[model samples]
Target: MLDQVKDAAREIADARRKIAAMGPNFDEEILGATRALYAPLIRKPSAAVKVTADVAYGSDPRQKLDVYQPAGAAEHVLVYIPGGGFVAGDKNLDGVFYVNLGNYFASHGILTIVANYRLAPAHAWPAGAQDVAGAVAWARANAKSFGGDPARIVLFGQSAGSTHAATYLFDPTFHPAGQAGVAAGILMSGPYLFQGELRPNLKAYFGDDPSRYAERSPLTHVGKSRTPLLLSVAEYDPAFLAAPTYELARAVTLRDGKSPSVAYFAGHNHVSTVMSFGTPQDDVGARVREFIASVG
Candidate 1:
């Protein structure tokens, strides 16, 4: 059963990559197809709400977030940000992503919040993070209204979203001027060094400021406070990028002053990690749920 599940998972992952490699013209179609794939698995579950609210405008005037929840859920909330190299993505297009995530947590009887923030190029580094932070504050203040547990909230993200999560986890200033911070966090396949010198793709969004890069890189901020975190990277995520992910994990270890638990999924690549959510017998999903449940 496990082998069969993994095999089917591989096929779905292949489709996910082909579409992503095709670029924007195919985004909606790919996302739509992915949603169809997940439809059967995503039971209506419990309570569900789709709420659109304003985030920070961030130089760009129009900035907003879409929040999703399960029916009658208690406050063990999760704030999920989508990854598109901090440049592209929308909550509307994230239906499949959030559906699987929301359903998974909802099945565990936990309230999950999937939010949209400003993206890059148009918005940039602190903009995306700031928008998410505002959403977090909103969640904290009204968690009870959504039937969620404010104190048990978790910040979770993948790829670029993982970057945002890591940034917020490390920088006490970014979360809020004086907020207590989240209980725990999960970063999937995120690069910790962001000084704009090493990574070309990120330079455009973060700019070429050594100080800004160092300050924003979570690795540089480790040990400030030990937030229980899980760092999971796909074993086959383009060989070139694997080292940075491990380095980021090591940073977490060094900063927390302990070896944080790291989960490596064999045969899984970068795009596949997010695709595995809510799939029965999916190893990565199981690990994520375990982490979220443990945190709760």
Candidate 2:
């Protein structure tokens, strides 16, 4: 046991050292590379589905989304949003991730829309939120045209994307244009509170506005919710995320909101959770699929 412990510690330390060496520019480079590398993979979706890229979703800058359609008609659609701490991430880069996830849901007869929202520093809190809302609106509006059921739209996101998804569903100004509201949401490792100095990096985007945090926090907005919610948090993510997910789930439950559900994925970390989206039988994927089926 001691020997195994030592070996594991050494491996962790080595991985940390390599990560540290990657430096501040690593995320930017990785962001660019990941997208370019995955673009081709996205173009070739599974044979069971039809894939479309760069569909005009919103106007101008936010007007981009990738749509995945199953061979057969679908009664439900899931809009998938990716995560990158709200700093630097794009849907084009996440094409492969969404493709596989779409394939999974498509196999289960659900169309999927992978949306790209404006990132922060250039575009702040509500900008990305608005972009996501626009994409959802597009999906809902064109669901029938795409052979999907508009009444069964589901919002799915991970990490920062989860944060955006939660806020959009809960945010008063973010509801789909002229639509009643979404049916359900699946949030994985999302932060429910940003009023304080919880995350320094997040401050650049959310800012120090107490009112914004209060109004924007999903936990605070759950009372008026008209949709069922499934909040899943990885057990090993940062406390800033994990703790808030637990607290928000409790608060929503206490508020008598749609019997909100909660789950913690064991043996999974933050990055691993979202990256495991379409992987078969993985902890995060299994929980997400189960939640989707229940909500469907």
Candidate 3:
């Protein structure tokens, strides 16, 4: 047991050294590397919500959702999109990612939908956007089966999932149309506006065509969006993730009848900002609940 503890400590120190060596620009990579260690350390809350798994929203195998229904009848629903920089992420982890996010909110009485979308490289930019919108449409059509209120549905997104959620809601071209009937949104640590310095794998996820960037970027479409938005950034997040959230909040407040909120998660980094959802460490989850309830 002592040796195991010592080895884990060494691994943590090694992860920190890598972060120091690579700098904040590699925040996503550093977060991914440390997540296997940190994610398991955080305990999973006992299941208080009933789960319905692998409900299909699209023909693709990845286009599926896990619905978390509260103990009592639900009055609101949240469609959660997990993050993996548009390329890698899953809706379920033993105690991390969307599983924790879905369980926490559903346990709080909001019927939560955690959905998987097609990944990048093999499936790029707009594919993520399309999948998210499809999930929202599915949730809207199927909310009542789980005793949820469709009119009060909110979209909660983290990391790349935030980008897809914003795109589905904000972009004029989207099919399910994020702005049509969705009540609110919570977008956290998304690299929506800037993709200028992305690594090769990420760039491939967004596509090789630089010319399509402005055409496909969510930052360009926020002016047309009217959804009540809560934008969050972590204090220790990389500059690329933190800066645009501030800019977006400023833009959101300018629009008439749009109530926008912004928060900085202190002492948390990109992944932990979202991973802390079901734990006592959660600070942003409270804000998200407040935002959705206020809108309802």
Candidate 4:
């Protein structure tokens, strides 16, 4: 057993070292290259939970969601939006990671919904927000059917999904469908404030004009949001992301009204932090659960 532990430790250390060596867009690059390799490695939880499959929220095929209901009645609802830099990502990618993530939460008595949204280049900013809103509406109206509370809904997103969810919460005009509400938000590893460094793909979502970048950023409106936020960054995250994360947090802190809860995940990079859900090393998940409990 000790030898197995040692071997696992060495593998994680090696992975981190390689990730650090691969600079710009390292998180996206590394994960893209290794999804097939990681797929077989993830083990689903032993807990039994009821699940409702592939429910549509929007006309787009991508805007579908899978809802998981806990064994018992759930009062707190979690809506998960994935990140793909506004270009790629699905609820079932790299061995159905999000499905397992949803199950883990459901097993713990949190009604969880794993949502999908339209990707950029084909569809842009407001489109993603609209899909998210549609999903929120579906959850709110149907929460009672799944034994979940409609009032305690949390919006959770990572990377580009963060941009969309944050926009929905911060921007005054992007109302969610059916007047559904978001009680709290979890923003992780998002490039909310950075300018002039967007990669080629980001143009699809943010647009071509460099001068208009600020208009696309949530930083400009994050302070306007009254909902409590938990903003986090990985310890080994790139400099660009690290800076904006703290910048956003500081901005929220300086706000006259409610402030954001902040955290930094030690020994993790942008990818690892989100990928750590349901594992023995579930520090990030614990943080998320604690944050949810505090608000829910």
Candidate that would win on TM-score: 4
lDDT of 2 at 13: 51
Locate the minimum summed-lDDT window of 10 residues in model 2.
35-44
248-294: candidate 2 lDDT, tens digit per residue = 77777787833478887754555555544444324566677677777
Candidate 4 deviant stretches above 4 angstroms? 1-29, 32-41, 176-180, 257-259
Who is ahead in lDDT, 2 or 4? Answer: 4
lDDT of 4 by residue, 1-296 (tens): 99968866666666556555654455545776445333444557655688787899878889899998898898799999998878898887744677767877887789999999998899966787778778888888999999988889999988788878887777766765444288888888888864685787788887788788887788888766778789998877778767778888888878844456888887777677767666555578889999888875
Report clash pairs, candidate 1. 46-71, 47-70, 47-71, 48-71, 75-148, 75-149, 86-120, 195-213
Candidate 4 lDDT at 237 equals 74
* Alpha carbon lDDT of each predicted model: 0.66, 0.70, 0.78, 0.78
The digit string of per-residue lDDT tens for model 3 on 1-296 reads 99967765675455445434544554446766656535654556556679889999999999999988998888889999998767688998653666777788888999999999999788987899888889988988999989899988898888889988888778868744344558888898886775456677668777667777777888888888777788898766788778878877777777654547888776566776666676554467787888888876
Worst 10 residues of 4 by lDDT: 33-42
**Candidates 1 and 4 compared by lDDT, better number:** 4
Error of 4 at 275 (Å): 1.4
**On residues 1-296, what C-alpha lDDT tens digit does candidate 1 reach at each position?**
99967776775566456545533332345545645555554334344544434444234443554445556666477878777767676544545655566566665666666667776566667776676677678778877777788998888887778887777877777775565367788888767676435555587568767777887666777666477888877655655446667887777666666788788876555655666566642677778778877885
- TM-score, cand. 1: 0.78
For residue 172, what is the lDDT in candidate 4? 63
Quote each prediction's TM-score.
Answer: 0.78, 0.80, 0.85, 0.88
Q: Scored by Cα lDDT, where does model 4 land?
A: 0.78
Error of 2 at 202 (Å): 1.3
